[model samples]
Target: MSTPRYALYYAPAADSPLWHFGCATLGYDAFTGEDIAFAAPAGCNADRWPQLTAEPRRYGFHATLKAPFELAHGRSEGQLRAFAHQIAAGLSAVPLAGLAIAALGRFIALTPAGPSPALQTLAFDIVQAFEPFRAPLGAADLARRLASPLTPAQRAYLEAYGYPYVGDDFRFHMTLTGSLPQDDVAGTTAALGQAYAAAVPAAPAVIDRLALFRQDSREGRFRLLDSFMLGR
Candidate 1:
């Protein structure tokens, strides 16, 4: 069946205009301006992480609900798009409440310093609404997880929901730098911080819209295909 594929993304389209500030720091070519190339300063090379502690490995620079999934048998993209539109309408803006960069120890990511009901609601709504389209985790994906030997908690969570990251476990972040060697951490953090400051002048109010990404074939970088605005 040509290895049918689809993705359930965070729909970060509204932020796409400036998301490059976040993506570029992490070495992803944000589909914004002329594709620019950037490098990690010192500690955040990311190649050195022994396990899947890296954003690229787990979740790109995004905060996805389902991390994209192939539609199960007897499903179509048109239906998926319509379903997404419905979900977007029900969601209010994710709130521009201003975020901050935190040391996730090995990595640096943007997170809400204080609690925001808007953020939590959006996450729950996105995950639960589009879940019906999620296909069962395929063998390849499952094998990769088993290869890493899930922890007791991870295994238990997976057994129950097919994904180790969810609900109470979910944290919203826009990954900026990768985990680096202990020695290189300082310079990398400064470089990334400066980069973000230079990127967005001020935060906008109410983030609305969803982005749909499709793989060219297979083994291709996820690219922005279309964007569906919130509600309508």
Candidate 2:
């Protein structure tokens, strides 16, 4: 059997406009692991989009609740599934007021319009709850993370959680692009804002489900493995 890495993510429902727009923009569907053809944003170069979105497209459109990790030794995929189900049953859904397109460093992403304490709590809980199943970062993985300049708190989180961004450092973002060139940032940001406006509802977005995604290998695209409803 292939050793798959898993992650817990908050992806929009397949039927939602946000899902359609996100998948189209990225040109890859996490649910089906298929490439899609979509129009470029108005006044933008069509040829540049595929290259621009390539990195995030591999991971699909979702906010990371639990960063991807391989299963620990002696752990089974079934055990992880049951644990995720248990976690979902105990947590209530959070209602995000809205999402807006914004710059996250050099990349663009959809971020929550306002603070949602409930969302933060849920993300923190998932990180802690699933720590046991996460395999320790291999030497190469650890080295790669350490090579980046990180704050003390981020380093501590990396040691404790196998990922640097967790707990207080966590900021929910569904990535839209890889690092963009300086000249492209302004135009791309505006384009994303206009393109995603219809998909981001004026009303609140309800986070009522948690999805499990799997990647068959380090180079593979993640695909939806299963979904568990919240508050059940």
Candidate 3:
């Protein structure tokens, strides 16, 4: 069997309205590993919403902190969990003005309304602190990553960190859909934006916890293992 893969991610508190909204939009709850009813936003049809969300549903609702990785040869899940706790303990929550639905390239996601220096530092620190636990990308994975066009800096990051989006290339976003047809982007974004504003509280969004998600196999959906409260 393929070794399980784990990811460090930022997710809203499971009991919060934002969490329910995100999970319902994607039609899957990673916390429970169960499919849920689709909460299609105003402009999207039910049939199309599922197809649009197919990709993110597999990984669950989250902003990537550290992308998925297999454990290093000498590392174990217990050790990773302990290390994650230590990292979270030292980090305070990051606050954002709010999130806005935006189209990133060809995909839809919720992005911060304003940049947060503290958030950037937290993400970078997680990437660095968790490096010891990540196995180097396999030959096939490395080749696949190289197949994508990358700037020199991104290429360097991929070689060093197993993911290209780090440092200046990183943007925190909770994905809402897979790549979309050019015609669909604007409408989808507008509709989801409306739904998001209605569903999510207007208060500032806080990155208060870090969640650990695990995928049992390449084809499997990632499930939440646990969450560590920041600075607790």
Candidate 4:
């Protein structure tokens, strides 16, 4: 892989019950080393973990509100850090209505149970407010993301953002599993719903902090980089 570009990500608390339970409940793999290799859970292999089949092991449970961006022209790390500090400083604390496990396309995802105005605005702010820092996407990068089937609009987004999912195309989701097979779609959806119903609490989840995460490009595993308490 080329030198990995820096990105801003909204990560979950590393040791929170949210992280532990969410990570374990889903079949996402843990980091083995600084490389991409990962192992399936000993008791539950791929065949049993059908939902995990379609997703690559690199990206696991963390929900990415704004996909990582390369720094804009001449922008230095100090400037970026300053931007982070300022963004964190001014951002209003985002209150959350508890998100639920909903099927996002083919995967199991975490989505807002109620209209989360704060969360939605926060996501939009993270993307737009940082536009001053976003580096332009290149032809080679565009060519690569274009490998996947997409509408002309999605292609436009990939050419603009490092990722294709954004704007009207964006649906805030935290992927829990990979795409499901046709035969298992209904059953798997029901199974996942049952699992979440049995597992997730029926209480409201208050948003107090914004988490930052990083991945050593070659390594598939991601680690908590930093976290800022939402002062809003």
| Segments in model 4 whose C-alpha atoms lie over 4 Å from true places | 26-57, 76-79, 147-160
Candidate 3, residues 126-217, lDDT tens digits: the string is 99999999999999999999999999999999988999999888999999999999998999899998998899878788899999999999
Ranking by lDDT: 3, 2, 4, 1
lDDT, candidate 3, at 117:
85
For candidate 1, what is the lDDT?
Answer: 0.59
Backbone clashes, candidate 4 = 2
Steric clash pairs (candidate 3) = none
Best by the lDDT measure: 3
Candidate 3 Cα errors over 4 Å, as ranges = none
Q: What local lDDT score does residue 147 receive in model 3, on the 0 to 100 scale?
A: 95
Better model by lDDT, 2 or 4? Answer: 2
Better of 1 and 3 by lDDT: 3
Candidate 3, 110: how far from true, in Å?
Answer: 0.6
Model 1 alpha-carbon miss at residue 15, Å: 7.9
lDDT of 4 by residue, 177-221 (tens): 677656655566666566566655666765555555445563445
